[model samples]
Target: MAEVKLFGFWGSPFSSRVQMALKLKGVSYEYIEEDLPNKSPSLLKYNPIHKKIPVLLHKEKPIAESLVILEYIDETWEGYSIMPEDPYERAMVRFWVKFLDEKFLGAAWKACWGEGKEQEKAMEDAQEVLTTLENELKGKKFFGGDNIGLVDIAANFIAFWVGVIQDVVGINLIEEDTFPTLFKWSEEFLSCEVVKGCLPPKDKLSAFLLARKEAITEAAKSIVYK
Candidate 1:
C-alpha cells in the first residue's frame, strides 16, 4: 500500500481542490487539518518557502501548491484522469488554471475584501474576469468538457468559496442572469458527488468568512483612527 498524507484547511478552496482530485483518483490519504495562523511543524518543514496548506506527502516526499499536487496525483495514481490526455488540451487546461489562480482569484478576493474606491475597482476587474470565464464556459458543461479536470479543480475557488465570501461581504459578483454560462457551470460542478463530498459545510464556511470580514473591517477602522 502507498503512504499518502495531506495537510490542508477545511475552509480553503485550494485545499479542497487537492481533496477533490485525490477522491476522483480514488486515492486514500490521511488528512491533517492545519491551523493557518499557527501552521504545523511538518507543514513548515515540507513547504518551507510558501508555508501554505494543501501539501501532499506521498511516500514521505512532499508536493506543494494545489495545482502542482493535482498534476502529481493524476500522474502518480492509477485511477480517473484529472488532466487531459492530448498535449494541446493539457496546455489549455494549464492556461485556464493559471488564469484562475493568478488573475481571477486575486480580483475576486479584492472585490470581497477591499473598501471604498479599491472595492469599486476590484468589482469591475472581477466582473471582467467573470465575463471572460462565462464566454469560455459557453456550451460546455465543465471546463474539462464532459467531466472534471485540472481547470475545473483549479476553479473550485470561483465556483464555491468566492460565492460564500461574497455573501458574507453582501456583494453579488457572480449573478446567474449576468453570467449565465458560468453560473450553469458552477451548478453542474457542484452537483458532482466527488465535489459534494469534499466541500466544507456551507454554514460553517459562512461563519468563518463572516468572522474574517469583521476582523478586516475592525482592522481598517483601527488604521483610520490611528
Candidate 2:
C-alpha cells in the first residue's frame, strides 16, 4: 500500500474537491484537518507560496492547489479518471473548469459576502456567469458528458456550498426560476452518493459559514470605512 495524506479545511470547496476525487478513485489516505484561521506549520512549509489547505502529501511529497492536486491524483491513480480520454474533450473540460474558477466562483463569493452596492453588483455578475454555466450544462447530466469529470469536480461549490453561503448572507443568485439549468445541475450533483458523502453536513456547514461571513464582511467594511 502507498502512503498518502491530505491536509485540508473541511468547509472549503477546494478541499472537498480533492476529497471527492480521492474517494471516487477509492484511494485510501490519512486526513488532517487544518485550522484556517491559524494555519499549521506543516501547511505553510509544504505549500509555502499559497499557504492554503487541501495539500496532498503523496509518498511524503507535497502537492498544492486543489485543481493541480486533482490532476495529480487522477494521473497517479488508476480508477475513475477525472478527465476524458479525448484530447479535444479534455481541453473543453479544462476550459469550463477555468471558466468556473475565473469567471464565476469569485462572483458567487462576492454575491454572498459583499455589502450594499458591491453585493448588488456581485449578484448581477454572478447571475450572468451562472447563466453561461447553466447553458453549458443544458442537456448533460454532468459536464464532460454523463459521468462526473474534472469540470464537475471544479463545480463542486455550486452543488453544495453555495446554498449555505446564500443562507448565511441572505442572498440567493442560483434560484430555480432564474437559473433553472444550474439549479437542476446542483440538484443532480448533490444526488450522487460519491459527491454527497464528501459534503460538509448542512447544520455544521451553516454554522461555520455564518461565522465566516460575519468575520469577512466586517473586516471588509472596516477596511473601506477606515
Candidate 3:
C-alpha cells in the first residue's frame, strides 16, 4: 500500500470533509494536526497556492483543496464511491458542490461575520442559496439520494458549523419552519456515523467562531472606516 498522510486542523469543516471521506472509504492514513495560527513549514511547502490545511499526501504527492481531495479519494479507493458513475449525474453533483463552496459559503461566512447592512445582505444571500438547495433536495434522502456523496460532503459545513456560527452571531437563518428541508438535512447529515465521529466539539467550535467573528468584524470596519 502507498503511504498516505493528511494535514488538517481539527475545527475546520473543509478538513472535516476530507476526514469524513477517508473514514467512509475505510482508507487509513497518518494525520498531522496543523496549527492554523502558526502553520508548519511542511503545510506551506505542500500547498503553496492556498497555504491551507486539508492537504492529502498520497505516496508523498500532495493534493490541496478539500473538494478536490474528496474526488481524488473516491476515484483512488475501491469502496463506497462518493460520486455518480453517470456523466450528467456527476455533473449535477459537482454543480451543487461548487455552489456550496463558492457562493453559499462566502455568503454564509459574511452573514455570521459581517457588520451592519453588510450582515443583513449576507444573510439574505445565504438564505437565497439555501432556498435553491432546499428545492434541489426535494424527495432526496441525502444530496445525492440514498447515500451521502459529493454534494452532501461538500455541504458538511451547513450541517454542523452553521449552527455554531448562528449561536455565536446571535442569529438564526435556519429554523424548523423557515427551512424545514435544510433543517432535516442537517439533522440527518450530522447523525451519520462518519460525520458524527468527525464533528468538532460544539463548545470548542463556538469559542473559535466567536474569536473569528471578532476578527472579521474588525477587518470589515477597518476597510469601511479607514
Per-candidate clashes, comma-separated: 0, 0, 0
The digit string of per-residue lDDT tens for model 3 on 1-226 reads 4599999999989999999999999999998999988999999999999999999999989999998999999999999999999999999988888888778887887777788898888889889999999999989889979899989988988988888888888889778799888899889998898989988999998887777776767765433210
List TM-score per model, in order. 0.94, 0.93, 0.94
Identify the leading candidate in terms of TM-score: 3
lDDT for each residue of candidate 2 in 122-222, tens digit (9 for 90 to 100): 77887888888888888888885778888888998887788877787777777899888778878888898999878889889988767676677765443
Instruction: Flag clash pairs in model 2.
Output: none
- The regions of model 2 sitting more than 4 angstroms off are 219-226
**Candidate 2 TM-score, true structure as reference:** 0.93
Query: Which candidate number has the best lDDT?
Result: 3
Could you give me the TM-score of model 1 versus the true structure?
Answer: 0.94
> What's the CA RMSD for each of the models?
3.7, 2.9, 2.8
Model 1 per-residue lDDT at 210: 76
lDDT of 2: 0.84
Extract clashing residue pairs from model 1: none
